[model samples]
Target: MRKAMPAALVTALAVHLLAGCAENRTAGAGTDTTGAEIPEKVSAGTVIAVGSPETKVALQLSGQIDELPFKVKWVQMSGGPQCSEAFRAGELDVCSAAEVPSIHARWTGLPTKLVAAEFRKDPHRNPIYELGIAPGADIDTLEDLRGKKIAYSPGQAQGALVLRILARAGLTEKDVELVELPSTGDVYPTALGSRQVDAAPLGGVNIKRFTTKYGKEGGKTIKHGLRDDPAHLWVPTESVNDPQKAAAIREFVKFWARAQVWIDEHPKEWVEGYYVKDQGLSREDGEYLVRINGTSDIPADWDPVVERHQKTVDLLAEKTGNEPFDAETLFDRRYETVAADAVADGRKGS
Candidate 1:
């Protein structure tokens, strides 16, 4: 007969496993550089030095096996709302969300720092923000949308973009009935195909697909793009403007910056995975998205990011009457340095 491990022991093992669930890790056994002991506890904000497979084996022989130097935590969110919850709870040290939430987060004193930027949504290539009306429907222009039903992913960069597009066309939420949906993709089918809705705002990927589909079927092409003026939009939500958070953000940015090159080198893998496997975009379409969105190869350096961020803030403020928080203050330079270093080291990505 065998006895189960003690509850305390079970709990201990669980923490270690959860901590290891994080990405960065350690090294292995005899003839190792550092024969450190396995850490026993984990927390938020600290790095997990023992997660590496190599380190796990080496730590087995070390006597110091009862301490966790840093706390490790994982973040899972569908959109900014979920991330906001984590931010409010003081549960997250760093998070990457689209631009819209970054505004609200900073507005509410979330202590987030914009250390780096990733991809920017391109209008020509990544025209995700669109107003789609049902095929063969009577609706023609923004004026036709009066009192008609519309779908949107509220509180996201896409939703905000859609709103801006409508405003540009002399429309507002007051002019149309708004339907809050998970995303442009979630209700895209019903909002555009189902008789329930007359018009729906969808992202560029959906626009490309649905447009291609309609064109193939000889359906009438409703006006497709309206937000094409600004080629691409950036994402740098909850970045810390200070040096420390800046450093962490730089590492975070480095990952994606490196991913850009890795994506180019291994096109079938990195790019496809982020756009298709992750975003559920089709293979060919995802490729098109890559060309359009233009990867953010720059690190956490503030100059370029500040300029773009300023543009976005100004745009948002003009539309919402809430000028964006001064972007310069929201940044943390330390993390920017990390990103700069990565690129400087020939680790620049696409």
Candidate 2:
């Protein structure tokens, strides 16, 4: 099992990184904690953490990252449910998840908080998931496929959200046949070409390209039923909102914001370096992937980008008869203060 960072280790990381910032602030900016020119070092700090993939890349690229007040750590998790589990076990500091998982994670008493959003606009989104119908299958829309076999996720995290699409399309679980597919991977290819199930919403790129391979191109798409919208976020909860936790959260956001900017500016590089090399994606496919889903970039702080995520959660909860947790409480806007500070730090350095 992955372990929580030890206090001594956290102390060491914090000091090493904070000392750099202290020195920078001293010789570079000539300022104190409040700009009073105390010239004293930041006393102590700890390791701040978040989920894998985006956060890990962000932290790695963060300039003077180790110079932050804490050692930043990131962990890769399977899905929202698993992340929620780790958080409950006190194994996680900050997590990235879809709006549904955030609500359900909070519902299960995870004491988590949502800080910033990871925006995904269609036409440039990744994995290109879609609800595909079998080759030449009669299914076209959610309503038409009533009584036709369909797959649902085990929990309300990834798969359950699909039901929201169905309900929005004037269909319910009872209206159509319901089947529980093992996972998204299994469900997608099955819906695309097999007779195992009728349809399932999958990431769009594959559906856009591969559906033609199956002679089903130009058919009804997954979005014909579900609207495209903002999806995930980087969240830290009440449990980790202490002064130390707050420091880490701030650094995570500041660095993450910078990383998004970098990715946005240098999508080609990221596709080659991170996605192609690190992820083992073929160069040709890598370029295709980058060209398509390579553009979810947004500013660091929570803005309209994050608000859309909030509305998505509320809408899903209303559809599933689940509770919509308090937006102000879960998605704390106070992180905006930390982001604002980060921007100032950037300007001062420039």
Candidate 3:
């Protein structure tokens, strides 16, 4: 019989084989990239650069920031579009966003993976967005969307939500005047107030601020009546490929999962720390946001989540004319149970 290989050599061979297998896996139908391996443990000097300000605030407020296994260099950034730019530059490792970013990234040929997912406990009651009707637009129902000029952003969650809303209302892009606009800052509300677009999805503090500023002029918002509550923590594939960084990312996901619970358990602190002090919102505005966001729900099973993502991908493809690929490819299932398990363990300890 041939002599057995050394333990170290055997371990090295296994890792090499695993990496080769990962390289053979499809990134997507039209993409030319593949995912990376998940390291078993964080190494010394591991640092995970992050661009999610809300998570940073949550960790800082809850003292979880000090509990991390590795160093995290916080980057002052937010939104999927911005995060994608940083990811492209190789300056950011992880970012938080809604579902559209990953879809858009894959379409744009960027190799990214969603590592964690979260949703509202009651998304229907606490939607992240509502359709804001322009002053004197006379659009009372989703059916009224017909013949209206709608603000659209193809690369953002609002754009995807607009498509979903139209589908729910039994309408199509052909039914409305799609005015492509950047849905950032006060753009949607500003567009509505100035009558540049008859309708746009407004979220967070903008919902109330829009009406408060233009209610006298007949500006109002209506429920979109759909699930627009996909919150995720995603990373560049290259970051996850590095052994140390991958291990650190795994630990970060655990903290992120627990952070959601901390937010739900300590709503007052979250509103104060994240919204008021960190975001510069007034106490009342912060409270309004907390109430609208409701509670966090991190599911143990991602089958249903992946299924919903498929629908989102299908919808985006239907509108954007991009080649539809498997949405499950966008998710790294290695992390499917990481967040849920972390939350469960936290609950047990408490």
Candidate 4:
């Protein structure tokens, strides 16, 4: 302060001090000097991460998640296969998938737990999956699939459901010729329409489109009256162990249950917003899908859910010649209480 310094020296010294301060500030804010953000500070209560197959409707519909306590990083995926891959790579903490994919995740020794389950409220007529035969094809019943070129995608829910249908009909993989197809929604109908495959499983809006294009007389859906088709929210073992993440998952389930109730109460909004707007379906198609699929509910107890899952696992094991594992062990019941409470609250509000 007393002695005058060279201008060059003073400038260099000031620059060094400023850089050091910047580094310190960045370091204190959980970022490195290179400006890379730090990992979550779970002990200090930080943001929560979530992944979903359907992002627009599942996460942001009707401002359902507008008041979440923890921050969420949403990842969009096409389906369960991608979600399971992401979960294995440590890129996702939680994912929503159908029962078969969730079972496959556990079968592959991935440390994942089914935290919650959603089933169509009208279980007797749950139109989650349908086996559709091509126009003018001779196939009629599940047993009629024999020796036919059926569109199949392994390790997918459609494939699993197909296997279940086959098993029920006293058929096996060898009983039919399976033409492997991409699991994309449109491929099934395309394959069937073009006569590339004799039969395939169709769901959602695709079912409506196929039936409309090739009427029930042209193409027919074999209804098996499947009742235990539950879609689940699966979380990794690491998240299950972490207190912060587990808490967030519990709250997320509660919110999800509330959203399901909202969807039931506001079917027109859901059909229009999700099917017509997000999925780009005609309004008539959207209405038909909603009417056919109906609404879903989260089961409060695990017994019925476990029983249904066991049936799926048993079928998979029998058809694929894999050993059956305990389906109950694959679930973490800690969230059941939270799910029950959430359902109760949702019903009250509805």
Candidate 5:
């Protein structure tokens, strides 16, 4: 109306506005730290981090955690991709996710470092990852999965497990159709129940619910028997460079190890609070998961763990047809001493 702006300038302005809006929209929703002031020291300002629901349980069960040296603002993310996004946006200082995601992050040249590794004491019997088939699907074994549509979330733990399972079966990604989906609570169930996917990888509470709802008659689960893929805690490179934030992370790692001991010691309480009340799973299912899938053991040493991760790197490289990077280089060993002390403290507390 009044001397309209040039179209090019107008479009550029609109693009800028939209990007700003998008950033603002995603800032603190669901598990993020949007508006919090960045602190020079861990004690002076809030440290925003991402973790699984279990992180909440650990914090809650670990009494005296409120007395932490730094203030932590935890955002609960379902899987690694979300955590990676938060890290990319500079919204998260630290995150907890499975091994593959951290490796993927490093592979993509993200400024992140693996601080600690969490292993299951009895991974085979209490495996945290599994692949499940639909109720009426004709798939019985891994070989039968060829050409079938499998629900997959790439770069997460499940995706890595699927690749391993396929490799064990002498198959490749070309052997099956991957139905890409976000690794969320309900996506797996819905995909399987509706027959949208022939098979899917599941973990944590979803595993309990799926098995209970489908049982043996309705559906079946395939255990991969691969336990080298451990979970990890990753931090932004900047945070590691910050003395205060690094110190806080060290303390947090010790607390997390002790929290696992608490969870193992008090399974019933954990089930009641985390599984039943928080996740809406039945008490029976909660108890089964807690007892069967024991808490993770935080290992301070990186050599053995790095060796295990190298295998994973090779697998990913083979599958994706990309050159493998050294897994050892991705790790930041500054926290090893602190983590070892934490493990000892956790044992003493237990």
Candidate 6:
């Protein structure tokens, strides 16, 4: 478990990051405690602490970061769990993550909402993960998951994917051993390679690397054959309630939406800029990533998105014995069309 950050230290970090912002504020730049309305324009003094490395890379590579209306202090956050910790510490305003973070936050009583949601154009064809079978494991299919020791991270997408896979296989938690583990960095692949768990979900370049290193030892990967692509820009509800931060978040979402389109339209540049240059992956590996991820899909209507989220919540609740609340509460409908509109406008940095 990670240790809690000291409050004073968090405050100092926030202040230091925001110290260079313009002193003069735009009209209607004050804080809004009533939650009645969000400011339409971002204030000059507004500085949003964002924790999305992928978006940062996209903006920087495409020169969109130079055109932002407000200041951004980029925070180094790895995944949903880290983002939640930063949100709890009042150090992060917004983050890009999977669907599990918002569900996990709400389950843990942290007030957060999904400001924007996205998915792959063909989710099954471009799944974010594949089940990695251990070197000596006898598993060959989803049904073979029974009686196996599976790696699980309760508040993460991989963990949820495991549950969904088991459900598809018509199995329950009692049917297999769920070894608790953190799926950060090379942990999952390392655990699978060591035979600590029979099967674990691996994503991005880890999928290819795992198979190559361990294929000689009988390691293999199986397609989960499930829709595991859920991309989101989420935030603590407090940020949306504040007028200045809310305005900045709104603009950020527009840019974020356009960035997805930009990446799809310019795959070669994306591979060169993001996967190879920024991430230090080989050109072949980067090309594999681009092929697997396919294209972006930002829906104009959130009703279907809400339905899918509810199903995820229900499955998670059933597997973990948590209460199943309405998933619609996890979304801020005010910005439902923001991303779609931005994509439609075909603007680089709106």
Q: Is candidate 3 or candidate 5 better by TM-score?
A: 3
Candidate 4 accuracy as lDDT: 0.70
> 67-93, model 3: which lDDT tens digit per residue?
898899999987787897787767899
Q: Cα RMSD (Å) per model? A: 14.6, 11.9, 12.2, 16.5, 9.0, 7.5
For residues 152-202, could you state the per-residue lDDT of candidate 4 as single tens digits? 666678877777777778887778876767668589988888888888988
Which stretch of 10 consecutive residues in model 6 shows the poorest summed lDDT?
A: 20-29
TM-score of 3: 0.89
Clash list (residue pairs), candidate 6: none
Model 2 whole-model lDDT (C-alpha atoms): 0.55
> What is the per-residue lDDT of model 1 for residues 1-350, given as tens digits with 9 covering 90 to 100?
12223323432453355343221211111122111222333233644111122112212222212232333243433346665555444345555455666665444334444544554445444454556667766777777777776665544676566566567667876677666555634466554665455666655566676677664433233454553322111122322322233333334444434434444445555445456666566788878765655544444445766676676677655554553668776554544565446556644322
Clashing pairs in 5: none
TM-score of each: 0.61, 0.72, 0.89, 0.82, 0.82, 0.89
Q: Model 3, stretches more than 4 Å misplaced?
A: 1-37
lDDT of 5 at 244: 65
Please tell me which predicted candidate would have the highest lDDT against the true structure.
Answer: 6
Error of 4 at 78 (Å): 5.5
Q: Candidate 2's residue-wise lDDT over 77-160, tens digit each?
A: 635766665665556767666566665554444455666565555532343345667665687666677777665553344455
Which stretches in model 6 have alpha-carbon errors above 4 Å? 1-35, 347-350
Off by over 4 Å in 5: 1-53, 215-217
For the record, the alpha-carbon RMSD of candidate 2 to the native fold, in angstroms, is: 11.9
TM-score: which is higher, 2 or 5? 5
What's the TM for model 1? 0.61
Model 2 segments beyond 4 Å from truth? 1-45, 58-69, 121-128, 154-157, 182-187, 190-192, 204-222, 225-231, 236-239, 297-315, 337-350
On a 0 to 100 scale, what is the lDDT of residue 316 in model 4?
Answer: 74
